[model samples]
Target: MSEPTPTTCMRCAVGCGHLQSGREDGHGVAEAKGNPEHPTNEGADCQRGIEETVDPGGDRLTQPLVRRGGELQPTNWDTAVGVVANRFIEALSNGGGDIAVLGSGQQTTEAVYALGKLARGGFGTRYYDANTRLCMASAVKAYDSAFGSDAPPPTYDDIPKADTHLVWGANPKTAHPVLYRWIAESAAAKDSQLVVVDPVETQTAADADIHIQPAPGTDLA
Candidate 1:
């Protein structure tokens, strides 16, 4: 085995830090462990984040492939980027009516900032948007209205310090395992309250001090 490569888990937005100890059996990953020093997860990880069964090249793109001639062919990053730039220029020349810049949740804060700048400053397009808006529009609007930002009210460090955790419509056990670890610990150690609001009895709800199971679509009532 070689030195474990420290990396972040991109399985979810929690972005837990972990170490990837290279595979030994060629069939499965030999070891995947969390970083003890990481402030976000604190040596904790979930099943999906730690235990992954990836068959080599199993529907995963290893390199950039651009359609040349009639099919996608492997190309260098410079060529691929150049091709995309040319396409963007051509589209802009055509009045940019067909141009739209979309960002994803996976992108870092710096990346999204650059993307927004590129869309508004470089491309001069008003059609740019983040994909999260389509799914979490109401939540984003509420956050912006209340806090003047779409980011979460509390940071990852603040979760454990909170006296009462009100988890609404989100199952941290699956979608955010790292967060669940802190919530569960805080509830156990500090005797903090964990209130889960969901229509289903999710794993997160099971660990809650109060599980509010309202009728689906009737939560406000």
Candidate 2:
């Protein structure tokens, strides 16, 4: 069999490289082994990659669908596009704050930028927010306090080599399963200490060397 094209996993932000073998819609399979040449994954694919072979394109929502009589019915692409565009234009002119655009930081960099421009520039709305705010805000704030900027300095590879790890207010196991694998590997093989602080008792917290659960809404205290 011929080799498949190398592409990154769109499933999550890990962006692990995968070899996809097949057409866009037809029967196909993807084999995901980490791209060692990749600066991040280092030839190690996590659970999502291993499971990509099953239901490679099974659950994807392709084509446009609209709810008619509370039932989603497939519609032509042009018709769906027109309807959505018209509704967006109407919302802009209707003078209502009820319309909000939600974006994801896990999206590709270009995809995020395009969505931002669509909301802030094209639609004249300033309520663009990424899901990362709820997950990594404290870590970002901590970095900004010390480095004078909010930026992720080290990649996943660096996590395994770091001496100290501070996981605050985020759960990696359920939310970021792949990254959690790296964390566990780091803690076991590298002797890196894990410190988790969260209000909820998450899988990551259960595994941490030091787990601190403060009172709800008392993160500042």
Candidate 3:
């Protein structure tokens, strides 16, 4: 293959850049590589990015499906579209135009934007939010309150330089092995302490300088 388009993974806050290669159908194979230009990654990829790849699945549909006679099958896209369209139309016609849409982190920015527009413009709904509201809402609130926004204070390089490294809540050995390597290597560099805190003991916990296993529901304590 020749060269591939460079882009970042939107899956997480790490936002590691990736190299995508394949045909023009948009379902391209991807891999995580170093992004020399990216200030944070600077040519490194965590496990999440390394294992990421193109979806072998074909183009997806937003249309609804109906089940008839114990079998689920595709109905007329137009009728399905019209059902939603008429529902929204009736909702607006009835002056009950409060609509809301749940967006997603996995979707590209354009898809999210279109969904937002559909809610606000098409349905006149102002209550649109992504499912991340449940996943990262608290973290966002705390980070914004402390750091003034979603800005990440530490880059991937900064992990190696921290004298005190704490691995809490998340087990990076299985979740993000490449990033966990940085922590392990940094701890081995002398004078740096690496601590693992979780409810369950994992491979990473076994290798930590200190492992604290809190009893089940007492993780927050």
Candidate 4:
């Protein structure tokens, strides 16, 4: 095996640093571990990060494909690029009524910025949105309303210092295992109270000092 390459895990927005072990032949990642020097995770990793590094190219599209006779067929990159460019040009010439870009929050910050620039600056389209809007709109709105901004006030470092942790509708054990470990460790060390409010009894809730199972959509009430 070759030397481990230090990289960040982009599996989620948390941005956990990882040291990936790969071959010099550049075939694929063999194994990975958390980077101890990372500020965000600090030698902690989630299952998703581990899975991603192990099978980085599983079920991935290596070549571009185009729909032909109602079936997607592999095609050359030039042809694929031409097809998409032609469609975008046609849409622009026809007043861009059907031109829109739908992005994902899973995309890297650079990727998201490039897409935004392409949509707004290159295509001049206002019909650009991301899946983050659907997933985090309510939470962002509440934060903005309360704090006049959508930024999260607390960092992961604050977990250990907090006397009480009130987790709502988030399963850190599955969704964010690294942070969950910190929270669990803090609770154990400080004997801090942990209040979990979720419709389902999740793993995090199981370890909580108080688990409040509110009815679906009735948490605010």
Task: For each candidate, give its TM-score against the true structure.
Answer: 0.70, 0.60, 0.68, 0.81
Question: Which pairs of residues have clashing backbones in candidate 4?
Answer: none
Write the residue-wise lDDT of candidate 2 on 1-221 in tens digits: 33666667676776766665664555455344566666555666666665754455565766679888999899999999998888887888865343578887567778888987887887777677876575569878988987887886777768878776788898877766767778877876656788899988988889889999999899965
Worst 10 residues of 3 by lDDT: 23-32
Tens-digit lDDT track of model 4 for 115-194:
98988888888889986686679879988998888878788889899888888889987788887877888887756888
Q: Candidate 3 residues 1-221, lDDT tens each?
A: 43666877654555666665654544456434656676555677764565545543456664467566887678888877776677778777765356667887777777878887877877777678885585578878878887897755677878878987888888877776656777888988888888889888888888888898898898874
Please name the candidate that would achieve the greatest lDDT relative to the true structure.
Answer: 4
Stretches of candidate 4 off by over 4 Å are 1-3, 21-28, 56-59, 95-97, 146-148, 199-201, 213-220
RMSD of each: 4.5, 5.4, 4.5, 3.0
The numbered model that scores best in TM-score is 4
Off-target runs (Cα >4 Å) in candidate 3 are 1-3, 10-12, 24-52, 56-72, 75-90, 95-98, 108-114, 141-157, 214-218
Model 1 Cα shift for residue 156 (angstroms): 3.0
**Backbone steric clashes in candidate 4, count:** 0
lDDT of each: 0.79, 0.74, 0.71, 0.85
Q: What does candidate 1's lDDT look like per residue over 1-221, in tens digits? A: 55677778756677888877666654345677888878887788877776552223357776789997899999999999999999999989977766899898767677889998988888878888885576579878989998999977788778678889888888987777777888888877666799999998899999899999999898764
Candidates by lDDT, descending order: 4, 1, 2, 3
Which pairs clash (backbone N, Cα, C closer than 3 Å) in model 3? 34-43, 35-43
Model 3 CA lDDT for position 55: 45
Best first by TM-score, ranked: 4, 1, 3, 2
